[model samples]
Structures are given as C-alpha cells and as structure tokens.
Target: MSPTKLLIGQIFIVFAIMVLGVWAATQWCAAMLGYQPQLGQAWLETWVFAIYRPWQIFAWWYHYDAYAPEVFDKAGTLAGASGFLGCAAAIAGSLWRARQASHVTTYGSARWAGLREIRKAGLLRPVGKFLGTYAGRYLRHDGPEHVMAFAPTRSGEGVGLVVPTLLSWTGSAVIHDVKGENWQLTAGGRARFSHALLFNPTDRRSAHCNPLLEVRRGADEVRDVQNIADVLVDPVPATDTSGYAGLSDSIDRHTWQLLKGVALSTLLGVGTEISFGDERSDLVRALRQSAQQNGARAGDQIVGRSLDIPPTLEVRPGWPLRVLVHRDVVLRPWRQGGA
Candidate 1:
C-alpha cells in the first residue's frame, strides 16, 4: 500500500480506538440510566468529556437540556450512542484504507522515485500522516525561501488535519515517537549528520497536540513545527516593506534552532541511543519573540513552554545543550554475541 494511505489508516485507528472506547463506555452507563445517544453536538461533547474524565459525564448531564440532552431520551441513549459509534466506525473505515498506503520506510528503489519526489518537495496533502521515517534522499530542510506553499484544509472528512515532513539524513537517524516515549543518543556525537521528516498530528489545529520532531544535544534542542510559521504568515499576504516580510523569509532564527534537534536525531539513528537532558527556556523572552515572530497574535499573555527555542540563553550562540531521553535503543540489540 502507499505510504499516504497507511498514514491515514494509523491515524484512523488511533482516533477510532479512543472514540469507540468512550462510546462503548458511555453506552453502558446510559443503559444503566436508560439512555442511548444522539447525532448532536451533545454527542461530540459527551464523547470528548467522557474519555477525558469520569466527572465529565455528570457535567454533560447537567447541561443536557440545552444541547445534546434535549435530543437524547433518558431511555434512548443507545440511539445517540449508536449514531456516534457509526460515525467513528465510518471514519475508521475510510482512514483504514488510506493508512494502508502510507507505511513505506524504504524509498530509494526505482519504483519509489516519483512518489519520493513529491514528498521531497515538502508539500503537504491536507489530512496526512504520523511520523513516517522514509530515510530517503527526499528529506532535506529547505529554508523558507525554497520551501513550497501548500494549503491546509479549511475542513476535513478524512483524518482531521495532518503535516507530512520528510526526514533527510546525511549520517544516522533517531526518532522520537513522543507519545511520552524517550529517545537517547550516547557517544558518537561527533558524527556530523542531519535529517528531516514530516509531522502530521490529527489535532494539529488545536492549541494542544503538537507532534513535532526535536533533535537535542545537551540542553540545546532544535525543533520544526511547520504550523507555527504558517499561522504567523496567515493575517495578510507578503508586503514589500521588508525582505523577511515575504513568504520567502518565513524561516527565521527560531526555525534554524528548531532544526538542530532534527539533525541530532537522525545522526543517532544508525549508531546507539542514550540519554541527554531537556532544555529549560526563559518563558518571558521566548514569549516576546514567539509573539513577535508570529505577527503578535500568539498565545495568551501568560507565557508558556515552547520547543522552538534553546534551553539556556546565558551561553553564547554557538554552544549546545543536551538532555536525557530515557528510552534510547543503542546498538540495536545483540544476537547471542554474534558479529
């Protein structure tokens, strides 16, 4: 199957498992209280809240009359639940087919050239993939001046939203499957290598759910979150006042720092994996820069953590900071001490 379809499938499976699990649980609870479900906003709210917390059910029940509760029959929650389940199933089915085509790890073979070229262009196809490490020649970080412009979906029928980054490697490759997973790079740090990969999280549009790639050496880590820059460029088209104003200048110092992590990760892919530490940032300074770079319409006045900056700012610009990733898989396992 194609890599794109496979990616859609994995995303579908992930969402389906979450949504269905919640739907089933909600159904059971409603049955106890003599209710089913509905095809209303309440159903969505209910499903979201239920999976997040048990107290949410009570919260929904309180406001049911105004939203979903008005439509749900106390003894007929099953119908609503069934409708919700059906949608989840349908989305899963659609994505299942798409996902089947996206898991291609190898891309240099003669047959993969055209597809690999499209991916190399760094253009995203709307609702896309998770982390697909093709380890191919198509992966390279082009400066904003060279990166292509791809339109994100205004709405979606497939996998919500996604960004596909290609990982270009010159040395080794290390991947952070960060669903709370840790990665480690030990020794071999001197090997100069770089890698680029695409990132597409289903909830990419949300304030949360940032699935990006970070390559860190010590506390100094660089990251690439494609959306951050695009959103900044959204307000108006490029004006001629400044060279950087154009889409051509979309990549900035922040972006350069972000890619450091990408280079470190792929460098360690073939060697060993070991722990390094995470970077700490000055929220005040980072907020100022992030907001400024993002066209002054960024996060709340309340400053927050961002992976785009380096850990410590006291050091000179050339130094690196490293962190520990607990789940580093160095040496790829030994087989009976054989060579």
Candidate 2:
C-alpha cells in the first residue's frame, strides 16, 4: 500500500476498534444489570447479542443454573477494562507534554549599571535633564529619612528609560545646559526651557563628557554584560523585533511607548528595593531618530526631519543627577565628535 493509504487505513481501523469495543462492553454491563432481551427469534442465540442494552446483557449473564458457567465478556462499553485504560493513558500523556514545555527555558541581563560607578561620573546632573517626574519614596522603618528620585522616561519624553536619581529629596539642584537648542536651564530659575539654545551633540570620545562602563567579577546576579555596563556610543535599540514583521510600523510606536512606560514604572511596583547616594555625574547620552523627535510633544513644530535621541541615561545606577535634553541635540557637530 502507498504511504498515504496506509496512514488513512490505520486511522480508520483505530476508530472502528473504539466503536466496537464500546458496543461489547455495553452488552456485558446489561447482562449484569438484569435486563430482558427482546427480539423476533434470536432469544436463544448465543453468538448474536444486543450491544447497546447493557441491562439486558447483565440479565443474560446472571445465570442461576448450577450446570451453567458464570462468565461475562465486556469489550465495548466506556467503563469496560480496555475503554477505561485507554482514556487514562491519553490523559497521562498530555500532562507529560505540558511539563516538558516549561522545562525549556531562556535567559538575559538587568544590571546595565552599577552603584559605585554611577556615583563617580557626576550622573546626577545629566540624569536630571531627562528625569522629569519628581518621585519621593520613603521607608516607614527609616523614619523621616527618605529617597527622592525620578525615572528618566517619566519626563514625558518619548525616550524615557529605566534609571533613577539618588539625591532629589534633600532640596539641592544645579542649573546646567548641554544641549542648548533642545532644552535650556533658565538662568537662576527651576524652569527647563526647551529649544532655547544651541545643542552641541557630538561623538562621545570627543564630547569628553561621555559616560563609560567598567566590568568586574564577584557579582551576585549574572547576565550578558553582568560584571558592568557597556558604554557604546549608541543606546539600547529603541524597538524590539520579536513581534510579527507584518505589523512593524504599528509595533514601533507601540513598542516605544511601552518601553517608555516600563522605564518609568519598573521600580514603582510598590515593593521594589533601591539604594541612594551622593556621588553623581553630569554626563548624559541622547539618541536621535531620522524621522522623529525624542522629547517633543504632539504640538511641537518640526523644523526638519524627526529624530529619536534616547534620554541622557546615567552611565551607571544610583547616580545623583539626571539629564533631559530634547531630541534636536543631534544636529550639532559635537554629536559624532563626542560619541
């Protein structure tokens, strides 16, 4: 027989066998249940018997004659020896498959920054530029002493990310401007004016103000780039590619917004543990997209092509300062030269 025919024949045979088994079991149960058999002329026939009438089969099998053998045959009913065992085996096989799926695991990293290094780079100032939402978290056990901070992404900028400031609670701040035309710190005031000055974004190595990462051993949590953060001229890829390709553009907008939200809310989940410090750096990093602006709002006028410079993220975690320059920071020569 052809392979295809053999496969079809096997499937047909299996189904036929199941139906036949159910019929046989039903006849046995009926005999044991004291059922009366009805027919035109087969009442005395031994080979031919009703399959669906289990009660009748039981009655036939309930022999009281001393000379007759007390024997029962069950092959077709759902509760018969064969039928019950088949269903039990099927259920057991399904459970084992599910267990195997969970055992197939995958992995990644979260320690993109460290506590000590974030302190040395004067991260507080640069981080503040990007961290707009002022957050104050207090521990009941620590008394009046509490930590005031903000995530970079909460500043309402599209590039919002997952780093926090360490000192914002003690009422201390400084006015400094790096991306002039993108955002400016009002002289002697707390207001951060946007698009008021010239932005001198350049390459990191040339910018000198670029943040760097250092790795080391003796870590508790390990992952790719675990020992320390990697300082690349570019930041994390703004969009993820794991989703379906057919819906990419829609996914791009959705992905960026989701990343911004997560970067803002990751530590706000009520039970997150955090630390604070006084050391911080003023260096900040920003990424610019060719078709969109990173920090501008819907009403903000567009002068040229849109760009997405990621938020001025801290070089390490637990930095005292943060930065928040607009996306326009890319148009300056300082950009490539500083990267």
Candidate 3:
C-alpha cells in the first residue's frame, strides 16, 4: 500500500485501541467502586483523570499503607501500560514498513539495463565505439555519445579496451600512442583498411611535416605566424622534464621576437638585408652591384620571368646549410665558383 494510506490506517487503529483501553479501565473502576455512572460519563472522567491525574493511578502502589485496606485503581494502571505499549508497537511497525518499502523502490529502480533496453537505445551495434560485453554479447554505442574511462596504472586500458575498439573501428582515428605499443599491435591490421601514418618527433625516419609551410601569404598571415610562435615559445612542457628545464622570461621573449620577425619576412616575401660593413651606403652599394651582375648575366636577352624567393628560410637543426635557388635561375657561375 502507499505510505499515505498506510499511515492513515495505523493512526485509526491506534486511536481505536486507546479508546477501548480507556473504556475497559473505566468499567473495571466502576465495578470496584460499586457505582453505576451515566453512559459515557465514566469514560470521559477516566480519560480526563488519565491525562490530569496520571500520578493517582500508581500512587497507591508507591504509598501503600499495610494497615489500611483501601482499594486502588489497578485496572487504570494496566490500561495506561497497555496503551503505551500499543503506541510503541505501532511506531515500530511504521518505521519497519517504511524501511521495507524504500528498499523495494530502490532495488526496482537501480537494476542494470537489460538486453531489450540496450537494443532499443541503439547501443548494440556491429561497427561503433565499444562499450562492454553483456549477456555473452558485445555491446557498442553507435550514437554520438561521449565516453570516458578512468583506470589505474598497469591496468589493461590499451590491450583490453583500446586495442579491441581500434581493431574493430573502421573510421579515422588519431591516437597518441606514447609507448608505440598500440601502433605496433593494431597498425598491421588497420593498414589493410585505411592509410595509417606514424609521426614521431624523436624518430628520424618518421614523416616530416613543417608547420611553417602551412603559413600562407594573406591578411591572416600575421595571426597565423603569431600562433605558431606562441606554440614554439610556450614555456609549459606537455610532459615531465629531466634536464635543462627552460629558458628565462627575457630569453624567451627575445626568441619569440626573432621567430616572429623571421616568420613574417618569409611568409610576406620581405627580406631584411644585413650588410657586413658598418655604413648604410655599403648595403646600398652591395644591392647595386648584385643587380648589375644579374643584368650582365642576362646579356641583352629578354628574361621573361624571375622565380619568387622566400624572404626567410629555416635550416632545421642537425642539418648542413645549403642554398636553395629556383631551377630557372642560372647556376653555371655558382657551380664553377664552388659556391
């Protein structure tokens, strides 16, 4: 039954018991006193006395005179005791019933979702993100729902969960395989389905992708260069560090400035000509001489076009510096000059 109905029923039963106990006690009092009072009069008096003169019921027991044979209201005392016992039992029963009902409600609502529910929700699928095994069947969530896993170290997060999903998943996935174990295990199988590439910074044989190459010449060129510079000069390391922690603030600022200048020049096709001599005229003279040499090389022949040169160029670390000239440019002089 509902809690409200159960509580109402308990209250009615308790009131009835209290009334019956008071009536029985009044009847016993009348018979002992040998007086027949009006109907309901004795009951009313007994209830009033029970409330106001409760001490009178047990007074005779505590202050009993052995020499006197005066009668006491023993029945009233028994009735009061029974009434208290009945109320206590009712309260205990109410608590027990409520506890039992709560347990039933909780157990009904907290059960795991069944196979039918899973299927209805579209979580049981063939090609999708893996959830777990249930009822000897593999469960997958094909819907666009976010999944997260939290597990301690040495647990089979990769082998048990990740590898299984990677092997089954046909869609594109970009995984950060720190130990390279995931690539080693699943690369062969996945290669058959899709083109897989591994990019490791420490590995020399890994694919090379220059971020600077992506910088284009446009209105947003400065913003793109700034973003790349921020990433390069960011002091926060992605993982733990061992030796040579980082550069100081001043040095980092200087490096950022240098990178920004070089990147802007390269992407914008503007070069800062550095002259070896101290005078500004020396730099102008060098440019004039270079132009005269280029004109002489053309030898009155109309040069239809000149190749565009990147204003700035980067030589990656651990590599020998070499000049990169356009194929259309004459290289006979440089070859003979041992340049």
Candidate 4:
C-alpha cells in the first residue's frame, strides 16, 4: 500500500484500539461494581448531566443578571459561576500542558521546518513524515532510560535495533549504553559508569547472534541523544519498489507523542505488566554473555554482526506501547537523507 493509505489505516486502527479499550474498561468497572453494562452508559450520562447542570444555572445567571445580579438564587448562581470558572481554569491548565509539550520538542530539535512548503508537497508527504519521525520511544525509570524504535534499519533489509541509554536526567539527558554498562552521573563525585545490561531482545544461542551493537562511553545530554536517535527513528522504506517512492517532507513528532502518551497512560492505568516470567533470568544472562564476549574494542564501537530480523522480539518486562499489525508490504532500502 502507499504511504498515505498506510497512515490512514494506522490512524484508524490506533484510535479504534483506544476507543475499544476505553469501552472495555468501562464494562469491566461496571462488572466489578455488580452493575450491568448499561450502568456504564448511565455513568457517562450522569457525568455529562452534571457538567450540563452547571451550564444551565450559568445560563439562568447570564440572562437574569446581565450586568450584576443584586438578588437571585445565591447557591445555584454561585455553583454555576464556580463551575464556569473551573472550566476556564481547566482550559488554561490544558494550554499550559500543551505549551510544555511543545517546549520539550524544541529541545529535542526538528529535522525540518517550513510547514507551508511541506503542505504543498501532498498528503503522503505528511504521512511518510509521520512514519519516519517519532516512531520510537524513551521509556524512563529510576536508572538509565531505554530509547527504542521498532522501525526498519537504514538498509531496510530488516527491522534493526538501536538501544541507547539516557545517563543523567538533569538539564539534558546523556545517551550511551554498551557492553552491559551505561554512562551516568554521581552526586558529589565525578561521572560513574554503571554496569547493567539494559536492553536485549533476542536469545544469544539463537540464529541471529552477532547483533550490531554500539557503545558510547562519553557523557552528554538530550541534544546529543537526539543525534543518535535521529538515525534509529528514521522510517524504514518498504521492501517493494513500487507502492512507495521517497519522503521529502519532515515528519510531525507531536502526533506520535500525543498518541504514545495517551496509550501509555491508559496502559499504566490498566496496570498491565507484561513480563517474560521465569525465563527473564535466561534473557538477562544472554545479555551478560553477549556483553562479556566484547573483548577489546576501540572508542565506542562494539564489534559484532548485525541481526537480520524484524522487530518482533521484546526486551522483556516492558509495557505494551502500541500494537502495529500492518498487512503484507515489502521493505525496500531507505534512500539516504530521505527521512
């Protein structure tokens, strides 16, 4: 399929999953409360009615007290006024959050600008742009954070892996992980390199050994991290030569941010902990073995053969970010500088 059609299909699927998940949640809640599924509808209606009730009172106040009502339903009017004020505050809060999100992107930096030029290119431009940019994530916890992308490799032969580490979570984030260690900061001391095999998606004894692994021993910030992330996050081209050509326009990172944010929030809210179970030890061991195999290497390069496989393997014990089940479409080599 063409990039435009692919994007439209993905948008619909992602949104449908979100809508269905919400509906399912409501039904589950009702069941737990010993109520019928209709109760879910009733609850929604009640909430809407409550918000509408305040509006009704506000309308009453508006007409009666056009200027300033000296005499009226004091309690009802006060309630309506408070609700109206609350709604305004909520809107302001939302704007503040959006502004904050926008600011973060500013720090992340953009690969391109000039929105008008991009719009003129056509719809596929934006869709391909969307696919190219922001198709990955930075999952953070107490220690080093994991930056992942399920997109195709630069070669577009297979879905490759680019696992980088975010060192310190201060002014900016430093990203580098290799040989079972991460670059991190220490309090009242110099930078300390912590030993921990952060992310490994496959078994060592498996056919796809000798994976392409790179390690940066230096400490940097978010600005630096983006440089490495940019390469990994670039949308992989379809193997087929015809259906798609190339991408000229820049991808909008905000769309993925919003979708991932909502999906993650819902996943966490639902308390979904996808674990690899007792086999986790073996996976971690595989990572350790892989790390140990790294004998001597110059600077940051960890010499190993690249894995030729799709992004089907999981790193273990991570939440399901999103489900991408697309139909049959070959992956062609990505054109240099296209993303």
Candidate 5:
C-alpha cells in the first residue's frame, strides 16, 4: 500500500486501541461502582482526564479502594497493557515507515549502458575517446561532451583505460600521466600517425613550450602577456591570515605584474623587426613607399633600355628587309620538310 494510506491506517488503529482501552477501563470502573456504563460519559471523562487531569488515572490507581472487585483490577491491567502496546506499535511503525521512505534501492533502477546503446551513441567508433571497458569490451565516447574519471590511487586506470585508449585512438588527446607510464607504453604506437610530445617539467627530455611566445604582438600585446603571466604565476588562495599565504599572494601578484611588464617589453622590442607598423597610417605609408620604389625601378629600367638603343637605327625604316628575311626563314622549314 502507499505510504500515505498505510500511515492513515496505522493512526486509525492506534486511536481505536486507545479508545478501546478507555472503554475497557470505564466498563470495569462502572462494574466496581455498581452503575450502568454510558459511552458519552466515558468519552467526556477520557477527554477531560487526558488533557487537564492527565495524572488522575495514576492517582486513582494508587488511591483506589481495596474493596474493588478482582475483575475490576484485571480489567484495569488489561486496559494499561493495551494502551502501552498501542503506543509501542505506533512508534515502531512510524520508525519503520520512515526508514523505508528514506531508503534508496539501486536494483532495477540503475543499469550499465549496454553495447547497443553505446554503439547507438557513436561511442564505439574507432576514433572515439575511450571511457572504460564494459563486459570485457572497450567503451568509447565520440560526442563533444566532457568526461571525467574518478578513481583511487594505485588503481588500474592507467593500464586498463589510459594506455589502451592511447594505443587505439587516432585522434588528439591530452593526458595527465603523473608517472610517465603512458608515454613509455603508447609513444611508439602513436608516433606512427601523430606527433607526441611530453611536457614534464622535471624531466630534461620533455619538450618545452614558452608561454610568452603564444602572446600576440599587437595593440592587445599587454593584455595577452598579462594573461600568460596570470597563468604562469597562479598562487593558492589565502585561507587564513596566520601564515605566509597573504605574503605569498602579494608576492605572486607583484611577480605576475612584473613578469607581464618584462614580457611586454621583450615582445615589443623583438616584434618591431617583424611588425609592419604600429598604426594603419604607418602601414599605408610603408606600402606607398614600396610601390613608389617598384615604380621607380620599372621607370629606370625603361629609361635605361631606351637610352641603350641607337638613335639613328630607330630613325631609319629598314623593317621590310628584316620582315622578308623572317618570312623566308619561316617558309624554308616547310619547304625543306617535304621528302
């Protein structure tokens, strides 16, 4: 049954037991006093005694007349026993229902993703990122969603998931291999199709990438250099003022600003050689100067060629003989070609 209906039923049963106990005690009291029992009077007495005169029942039992019949005593005992049992049952049922309500069951509610579902999600693609193994088969995730793995230290995460995935996956991946095991195991296989580089700071063989090189050299040069400096000099947030945390944070910020300034200066100084100009007008002026120089060179070549030609040769018209000779030379090949 639903919890609501079950709770309502329990309450009704408890109330019924309580009323029955009161009625049994009232009946016994009426018998002892040799008076007829009245249900209305019993209910009125119950309400008054239960609320304002709650101690009356115990006081009556302690000061009851010894002349009371044995049957009356037995009825009173039965009433007390029934009331105790009813209260206990209510308390126990409430606790049991609360426990059941709060309890969570994993059975039939949660299940691992099956092969068909995985394949349908395109996680079984050869180029997909490896998630883990399911039922002795590798499971991959091809979607763009992020995946995170949580495992305790000394687990088989590297051997089982990382290495296997790196060996089979053809796409690019960034791995955080603390022990350098992934590089040793999968480096050769990956090198066949991709350029693999390890960036371990402690190791001399690791490839180095200068963060400042990534900073763009333009109007936003300072901002870009500051961003790289921020990443390079990240400090832990201060948790308390008792230790060097505040001092460290101050030093880090100072160092970051100093590094940013130095980086900006270095890039600005070096970039001048490659940078066309600082402003659009400067670039336009440089382009105009280049165009003028190219035009001057072309003009100089034309003028030189014109000056190199003999003036008398150009003034006389002897082109008919030259044209006749060229025509004869062209026709001589066709005349001599015939066998």
Candidate 6:
C-alpha cells in the first residue's frame, strides 16, 4: 500500500483497539454487577458514573427543573460554591499535569531513555511515529537517541513546539516492516546520519509534509564538503508572508496529548520536511531569498543549489549539517553491524 494510506490504516487500528477495549470492559463490569450480590455497585459507579456522569448531567442540566434553585439559604449557597471550586480544581490539576508531562528531557539519562519510557512519558510517540514512518518511508528510529530539540524558527512558524526525533548517528537510518517492527539491512554499513520529520506551524494552509534530510558524513566519518551550502532549502510563495502556517491544531492539541497520550492529527496539515541544521532561521531566510532569486511563482518550489551566505558566516565544524532538498533524494536504509 501507499505510505499515506498505510499511515491512515495504522491510526484507525490504534483507535479501534482502544475503543473496543473500553467497550468490552464496560460490558464485563455490567454483567458482573448484574449477577453477583457481594460485589457492590460502588466499583461500577466509580468507573461509570464518576467518569460519564458529568457529561450526562451537563447534557440534561437545562432540561430539568432541579437546577432552578428556589432557596437562597446559607447551606445551599455553600454547596453550590463548593461544587464550583471542585470543578475549578479538576481543571487546574489537569493543566498542571499536562505541563509536567510535556516537559522535555534536557540533560542526562532521559535523553537516551529506552522506548518503554519514551512511549509513556514522551507523549509524542503516536503521531511522531505515524508522521516519521510515513515521511521516512517506513524507517524507524533504530536506537534510544531520541532528542526533543527546540527548533530555531520563530514561535508560530514552528518553533516553541518541542520537536522530537532521533538525531544521532546511532539513531540513523532505522527501517521498519509493515508490522512496524524495527530492522536493519544485513548488507550495508552504518553511516553518520540525521533525520527529523518536522511539521511547520506556518504552513498549516498547505498540505506539504516537510521531511528534512541532513547528510554530513558516511559510516567512515570523512567530511568532504559539497557545493550545496550544507543546507537544503525548498521555497514558498515569495509574496506569501505567512510562509506555511503549519497545522495550528498540532500546536494547540500538543498539551492535550501530553495529558492523554493521544495524537490529534495523523493526516491533516502536513508540510514539506526540509533538512537543515541548527541554523534553521538562517536557512529559512536563505531559502526565501533563493525563491526570490529564482523568480519562483506562487506554487513553485525553489530548491537551494549552493550556500546562500558566506562559508565563514556560521560555522560549527565539529558537527556540520548536510541537506538533501529534492523530493527524490533517498539515502540507504540503515543496516545492522555497520558503523
């Protein structure tokens, strides 16, 4: 199947499993309660009524006369105030937990934490994998080198969102099968590579899912600089100031995912994945300038052929960034026993 369709299928499967499990549990609980006299209804009430009762009450609140309080008594007033405080506390507690959950791992062990911890605490596992797998053409992160780096772009343009991806050589060219199992090619040797499936907040209008590719050195770690300015640029419409306002939902719904461990968008608002280094702001400016230089039309993609600035402009020699801008550029799938 095509990559896009396969992505949609995986998403459907995840939700289907979750929903079916919830329904089955509900049925089993109801059946047990109907039969056994010893098992009190308190357990079922806690699970069912405590969870769904709020919504049920809200739905019927206006339809019932019980909400019309004819009493201005001190007791009634105190009860109402307490209820409001309870609701407020619930909301505040939820927001606090969400902030804590989305906390990015900056230093130490969490940076290299295993998949189990990552899938649970990272909170970006589901959609990140969906988008990465699709954009990377079924490749997966081979190791535990996932990094939640802050993108250098402007806030609404795609920065401020904790972008997570495998960014090291040990985290290079990992491939996966149709069942989403990780596997490396038996023949090829390992290479120093970086891969990130980034979504732009500005390009929310366009459907281009940007996949950034940076190639610095091979497995041998030899660095031969190419004509390409170590940066790849795909241009947007020169006139459009809001160059790809990426999926607004992705940013807005991120906090919720932190709390619930669920991803919102699996298909919508995917933008072009351009490969660049830590010099993202500079690279974006250069790509725009290149677009202007090429006389690119509204929908044209202006690809960078060489460095947009001087060689000495911004040099990070030890960790040089490489980029492949074209749609067809494909690197070898990371293999086993190659370094």
Cα-based lDDT for every prediction: 0.40, 0.35, 0.62, 0.36, 0.64, 0.34
Q: Order of candidates by TM-score, top first?
A: 3, 5, 2, 1, 4, 6
* Model 5 whole-model lDDT (C-alpha atoms): 0.64
TM-score-superior candidate, 5 or 6 = 5
TM-score of every model versus the real structure? 0.17, 0.18, 0.41, 0.14, 0.37, 0.13
Which pairs in model 4 have colliding backbones?
129-251, 173-221, 173-222, 210-305, 238-331, 238-332, 239-330, 239-331, 239-332
The candidate that achieves the highest lDDT relative to the unseen native structure: 5
Q: Candidate 3, residues 69-128: lDDT per residue as tens digits?
A: 344446656578668967886997688677858646533557678778988988767877
lDDT of 6 by residue, 251-309 (tens): 22122222111110111111112232235587786865564444433222211211122
**Which candidate has the top score in TM-score?**
3
> Candidate 4, TM-score vs. the true structure?
0.14
Model 3 scores worst on lDDT over the 10 consecutive residues at 302-311
TM-score of 6: 0.13
The lDDT, on a scale of 0 to 1, for candidate 3 is 0.62
Model 2 bad stretches (over 4 Å):
1-22, 27-50, 54-56, 63-70, 73-80, 83-339
Question: What ranking of all candidate models by lDDT puts the best one first?
Answer: 5, 3, 1, 4, 2, 6
**Which ranges of candidate 1 are over 4 A from the true structure?**
1-112, 115-339
* Residue-wise C-alpha lDDT for candidate 1, range 144-225, written one tens digit per residue: 3433335454443112212223112234434443441111121122233442332435544323433333423344332232
Off by more than 4 A, model 6:
1-75, 83-87, 90-339
Better of 1 and 2 by TM-score: 2
Model 1 accuracy (lDDT, Cα): 0.40
Displacement of the residue 319 alpha carbon in candidate 2, Å: 48
- Residue 299's lDDT within candidate 2 is 14
